[model samples]
Target: MTILLFGITKDIVGSPTLSVPTSSVTGKQVPKTVRELKQFLGDTYPELNKLSSLAVAVNHNYANDDDTINSYDEIALIPPVSGG
Candidate 1:
């Protein structure tokens, strides 16, 4: 799965896109849900865990923690926005 990063998430990740293996190449379980995805990303990129608020979207729709994900799904990480 490829995760698109926006705002601070991009800076934190050092890239606009991240590729996640569908199969465990490192003996770690592949993320099958939004919640697990977050945990996986946080584990790989500790800086992401520091964000006060983070939102995830799957296939252009906002996804909840329990939302199921697949290798072919489009995932995006949206950080909290602040504007006047």
Candidate 2:
């Protein structure tokens, strides 16, 4: 799956886009859920785990914890924004 990183998420992955391995159940790179993606990100980049409450978007839409993702779908990691 290709995960798009925005805001601070870009710093976490060190890239705007990432090609992640697929899940066995879906036979695609899509992450099953927000939590699953978090775990995946943590595994791939342990540094991201230090951040609190990361957010996710699937197919240009914000997704919840129960949201299921598809391999061919577009996913984005949107970290909390901070500005003065």
Candidate 3:
């Protein structure tokens, strides 16, 4: 799965995008839900866990924790934004 990163998420991950391998290749449990995705990312990049708020978009739509995800889905990581 490819996840596009935005704002602090990009900074935290140190890249504009991240590539995650599928279970078939990694032989590890793949994240199947938004919540799991978050956990997977947070575990890989601990800085992500520090964000006060982070939103996940799947296929251009904001997704809830229970929302299902597949390797083929488009995922984006959006972080909190503040401006004066």
Best candidate, lDDT-wise? 1
Q: Which ten residues in a row have the lowest lDDT in candidate 3?
A: 20-29
10 residues in a row with least lDDT, candidate 1: 19-28
Question: Candidate 2 lDDT, tens digit per residue, 35-82?
Answer: 787887787789788877688888888898888887888988888777
Off by over 4 Å in 2: 23-30
Quote model 2's TM-score. 0.81
Q: Whole-model lDDT, candidate 2?
A: 0.79
Q: Write the per-residue lDDT of candidate 1 for residues 1-84, one digit (tens) a residue.
A: 899999999999899999999998879999999999999999999999999989999999999999999999999999999999
Highest-scoring model, TM-score: 1
TM-score of each: 0.97, 0.81, 0.92
Clashes of each: 0, 1, 0
2 or 3: which has the higher TM-score?
3
What lDDT does the true structure give each of the candidates?
0.95, 0.79, 0.92
State the lDDT at 30 in candidate 2: 45
Residue-level lDDT tens digits of model 3 in 1-84: 999999889888889999987675666578999999999899899999999999999999999999999999999999999999
